[model samples]
Target: MGTNVTVSLKALLLAGLVVIALAVAYLVGDSRGTPAEAASGGGETGSSAKRSVTVGGTGEVTAVPDQLGFSLEVRIIRPDLQDSLDESGAAMDRVLAELADHGVTEKDVRTTGLSTEPIYDRSRNAPTTLRGYRVVQRAQVLVPKLEDGGAAIAAAVRSGGTAVRVDGIALSVADPEALLAEAREAAVDEARAKAEEYAAAGGQELGEVLTLREVSPTYAGEESWSEASLSRSYASDMALPIQAGEQELAVQVEVVWRLAD
Candidate 1:
C-alpha cells in the first residue's frame, strides 16, 4: 500500500508541474509575440515592403489663338473740356450707329474708356497755357470673322468718327476650359517621361503612382498686340497682323514608387 501511494503522489505532482509550465509559456508568448505577429500580417508570411523616389519636369505647348479682341476709340479736341466731351460722345454715338448698321449686336459693342483731360501747351512753358481740351472714349469690338475685321475698322474710320482708334487686339482660345484639358494631359505625359528617366538613372523602375497634381495653365500673348495699342491711330482697312503663337500648361506630380530590384 505505501508503495502504491508514493507512485500516485509522484504522478499527480508531475501533472501539476506540466500544467503550470504551459500557463506561464502562454502568458509570456501573448505579451512578446502579439506585435510581431500583427506587423507580419498576423500570419507566417510577411507583408509587402515599399520603396520610392520623386522627380520634377517642365512642359510647354504652342497653339494659335482662336479668338480676337479689338477696341475702337474716338478722341475729340475742343476749346473747352465739356465741349470736347460732348463732341466725343456724339462721335461715339455715330460709331455705334454705324456698327449697328453693319449688323453688330449690342453684346458685341461695349464702351470702355471715357475721359476728358485739359490740354497743356508745355512746349512753351510760358505760364502753362491751356491750349484746348481732349476728350477720349473707347469701345471694344468682338469680331468673329478674321476677314471682316479690317472692313469693320474701315467703316468706323470713314464715318467721321475719325478719332476711331484701335486699343488692342488680344488673341485667346474661345473654349479655354476644354482646350486646357488637352494641354494638361500633355504636361502629365511629359512629367511621366521625366520620372521614368530619373528612375532609370537611380537604377529603379517606377512603381505605382503615389500621387498626382496639376499646377496651373499659362498663356503667351503676342508681343505686337501691346506695341500697336499705345500708338494712337485708327486701324485702317489694312488687315491687322495677328500671330497668337503658343500657350503653355503645367502639371506637378509627386509619385512615390517602389524601386525595382
Candidate 2:
C-alpha cells in the first residue's frame, strides 16, 4: 500500500509538470507571432526608408513691358497763391477733360502729388520776401497700350498742362499672382533636379527643404525701373523722345535642402 501511494503521488506531480510545460510553449509561440504579424501589417515598411536627395539652382526670364505710365503735371507760378492756384486749376481742368475725351476714365486718372510753395529769390544775401507762390498738381496715367503713352503726354502738354513727367514704365504680367505661382513651381522643380543630380553623383539622400525664398521683382525698363528713375531723367533731360518701351516683370527664388544619410 505504501509503494502504491508513493507511485500515485509521483504520477500526479508529473502531470502537473507536463501541463506547465505545454502552457509555456503555447505562450512563447503566441508572443513570437505578434512581431511577425505587425511587420507584415499596416506598419511602415523598410522600403520607405530609402533616402531622397535634392539640389538647387536659379533661373531668370526677361520680357518686355506691355504697359506704360504717364504723369501729366501742370505748374503755375505767380506773385499770389490764389492767382497761381486759379491758373493751375484751369490748366488742370483742361488737361483732365482732354484725357477724359481720349477715353481715360476718372478711375484711370489718379492724383499723384501736389504742392504749393512760396517762391523766394535766394540770389541775394539779404532775405527776400515772398514774391509769389508756385502751385503744382500732378496726376498719373497707366496705359495698358504702351504705344499710346508718348502720344498721351504730348496731348496733355499741348492742352496747357506744362512740365509733364514720365514717372516710370514697367513690364508686368496681366495676372501677377499667377505668374508668381508658376515661377515658384519652376523653382521647386529646379531644386529637385539639383538634388537628384547630387544623389546620382554619390551624395546621400535629401532630408527636407530647410529654407525657401522668393525675390521681389523690379521693372527695369530702359534702365532700372524705380519710381523715380525715368521721371527724374526725363525732367533733367527732356530731349529724349517719348517712346514707351517694353517692360519686364521678374521673380527669383532660392531653396536649400538638407542632406540625409
Candidate 3:
C-alpha cells in the first residue's frame, strides 16, 4: 500500500510539470503571432490613409509702368591717351549739364561704365600698328516723368555730339512689392480652387492641405526699346514716340491636399 501511494504521488507531480511546459509553449507562440497580425493590420490602414492629390495653378496681373530708364555712352579717339580721356570727360560733362537742365536731378545720373583701349590698325601688307587711343564712358539715367525720356536723350546727344550713343531703354513700375503680393494671393486661391475640383471629380471631399510650394514668379510683356529704333535723329522740340504698354506679372504655386469622406 505504501509503495502504491508513493508511485501515485510521483505520477501526479509529473503531470503537473507537463501541463506547465505546455502552457509556456502556447504563451510563446501567441506572443510571436500577435506582432505579425498587428503589422498586417497597420499596413492595410496605412494604404487606406494615403489618399491625396497634387495640383498646380498660376495667376497674372497687368499694370502700366510709371518710370523710364536708359543708358548713354560717350566715346572719343585721339593719338594720345590723355587727350582721348580729356575729350571723353568733357563730352560727358556737357551731357550731364544738358540732362540737369532738362529737370533730371544729379541723384538720377550714374556713371555705369568707363574704359580706355588702344586702336589697332590692321591692313594688308602692313604690320599691326597702334593708331590711337579710344576712351568710352557710359552713364545710366532714370527719368521720373515718362515724357522727359525722349527730351533727355536728345539733349545728351546734342551736348555729346556724334560720339553719343543711346544703348537701351526699359519701362518699369516704381514699386512692385504690392503687385507681387497680390499675385501670390491670387495664385494660392487658384490652387485651392483647382484642388477642390479634383477632389470632387474623384468623389472625395477635400480635407486639409498636405503640402504647399511656390514656383518662381515670371514677368511677361515688359517693353524693352531697342537701341536702333530710338537712335534716329530727333529735333529738340519733338518728343520721341514712347508708349508705355502694359506689363504682366505672373505667379505660380503647387499644392497637395488630402481627401476625406
Candidate 4:
C-alpha cells in the first residue's frame, strides 16, 4: 500500500511540472511574437515616412528637313468601268515613268489607294440617276532629295495632264534617332535642374531618383503645303518652287526624386 501511494504522488508531481513548462513556453513565445508584430508595423510606418517630389520638363531641337513626301492621284470618269480603269492605268504608268526620269525610284513610290465609285446625276427629280463610273489611283512618293520635289511634282503633272492631282507635300527628317536622343538628354537635364530648384526652395536637398518615365515625343513645325494653288499656277506656265522648312522635335519626361534633409 505505501509503495503505490508514493508512485501516485510522483506521477501527480510530474504532470504538474509538464503543465508549468508548457505554460512558460507559451508565455515566452507570446512575448517575443508581440514585439515582432510591432516591429513589422513600425517598418511599414517608416516606409510611409519617405519624402519625394515629381516634376516634368520638356526640350526641343530644330533641324532642317532632309526628306519630302507627296501624294499624287490619277483619276478618270467614263461611262464604262473598263474604259475608266484603262485611262487611269495609262495615266498612272506615265506618271510613274516621269517620276523615274526625275530620279524617283520604283521603291520610293507606293500605291496608297485604288477605288471605283459610281457618279450620280442629281439633276433627276425623283431618284438620282447613275451618270458614270469614276476610277481613282493614288500613290505616295518619297523624295529623298528635297531639291527634286518641285521637278518631281511638275513631271507627274505633265505626264498625267489635267487628270493628275497633287494632294500635298510635307517635309521631315529622314532619320530622327539622333535628334530624339539629344532631345531626351536635354529633357532629363531640365528635369533634374527643376528638381534641385524645388528642393532648395523647400529647405531640402535632392536625393536619388525614385522613378523616371519618358513621355511620348512630339514633332512640331511640320509644314504641309497644299498643291491646289500651285497646280493652278503651273497651268499658267509658271515655275513651281518648293521650300522645305525646319522641323522641331520635342521630348518630355517626368521624374520623381527623393528629398533629403
Tell me each candidate's TM-score. Answer: 0.60, 0.61, 0.74, 0.76
Number of backbone collisions per candidate: 0, 11, 0, 0
List model 1 lDDT by residue over 1-261, tens digit each.
Answer: 999999999999999999999999999887656565655433333334344565554456566565566778888999988788788888888877766665567888877778878887775546778889998888788765444554455566656445767656666656666656666676667767877887888787777777666565577663333425332234444434555566544444444444554
In candidate 1, position 165 carries an lDDT of 70
Give the candidate number with the greatest lDDT: 4
Ranking by lDDT: 4, 3, 1, 2
Compose the digit string of candidate 3's lDDT tens values, residues 1-261.
Answer: 999999999999999999999999999876665554555443234435457788888878887787777888999999999999999999999998988876788898888889999999999998999999999998898878777777777777777777888766777777877998898889889988988998898888897888989888776544555555445534334556678788888889898888885
Clash pairs, model 3 backbone: none
Model 4: pairs clashing at backbone N, Cα or C within 3 Å: none
Clashes of 4: 0
What do the candidate models score in CA lDDT, each in turn?
0.65, 0.63, 0.80, 0.84
lDDT of 4 by residue, 1-261 (tens): 999999999999999999999999999876665554555443233434457789998988998887778888889999989999999999999988988876799899999999999998886566788888999999999988888777777778877888888876788888998999999999999999999999999898999999999999988654555667667656764435777777899999999998887
Model 3 alpha-carbon miss at residue 162, Å: 1.6
Better of 2 and 3 by lDDT: 3
User: Over the full model, what C-alpha lDDT does candidate 3 score relative to the true structure?
Assistant: 0.80
Q: After superposition, how far is residue 30 of candidate 1 from its true place, in Å?
A: 27
Worst 10 residues of 1 by lDDT: 224-233
| Displacement of the residue 175 alpha carbon in candidate 1, Å | 1.9
